[model samples]
Target: MNLLVRRLFWISFAVCGTVSLVWGHDVGEGDLKVTVLAKSSDAWDDKPLPHYPTGQPEITVLKIIIPEGKKTPLHFHSVINAAVLLKGEVDVHMPAGETKKLKAGESLIEVVDKAHWGENVGQGDAEFLVFYAGEKGEKITHVLHGDETPEAVLQEANR
Candidate 1:
């Protein structure tokens, strides 16, 4: 019993130490750590957002910060992507689709072929983290149209 307990304790400690080291061990004291409230993995539901990892030149992780009531211009992701809501509520608009409200602790997988726009509907700013599986210089978004889409429902949703 004593030997088993000792082995378990050492194994747990080693696993935690390895995780801490691999996560973010090289940052200097003054380096800033930005947190995106939107699309945080911590909010993942039963099924984790799909991961389209393209083994290419490099992997890109992008973080976007949105102020309260602000919305991202319409765009589309070029590669397979996943977004996590880290801090606040985000209302996302999809072209030819409906608006979905994503709150902190929730994650969304963007449709590969659709244009998307997001707004911070919560009282505070929202943060979004996106991981793309593509080459570093690849363009993830192609703007189809601005908020001025002719769809009356979409226009009203924007407001």
Candidate 2:
């Protein structure tokens, strides 16, 4: 019967619509998208990442907030680390005076056993997430005071 055929057609249409809606569309379809922000074995400074330490592996994630116009303490990380800038702009400087600038949504693989620091240069707080790979009982970050020199910091970090 005509009515029976019409019902089947409508049901098929509805099912197809539901399937498309649930599965969504791919990149070319413009319904969803993905991006590779960063991928590398070297830090932003072009230095190769250090070898993993021996012992119980530990992974640490830190959410750091730097107030506008403020600077973080000069410090060094003993292990390999990376970061994604979530908000505002910041400039990271190495003890040797080299600098790397970053803005919101940007990422950087950080230097290991090197003294460096960051300054929030934007109009708002600079926020970032840092991921560290290290071993248990090992200190990841070593902060240096105004009186401490970069050489001292590096020596401490290497030790």
Instruction: Give each model a TM-score.
Output: 0.56, 0.74
Against the correct fold, how does model 1 do in TM-score? 0.56
Candidate 1 root-mean-square deviation in Å = 12.7
Q: Tens digits of per-residue lDDT for model 2 on 1-159?
A: 454345434433432334444346654775544454566779889989767655666667899999999999889888877788999999999977899999999988898877899999999899998877677778888888877764686676677
In order, candidate lDDTs are 0.60, 0.78
lDDT by residue for model 1 (49-75), tens? 334333333345678899998998887
- Residue 2 of candidate 2: its Cα lDDT? 59
Using TM-score, give the best candidate's number: 2
Worst 10 residues of 1 by lDDT: 37-46
Residue 75 in candidate 1, Cα distance off native in Å: 0.7
State how far residue 99 of model 1 sits from its true place (Å): 2.3
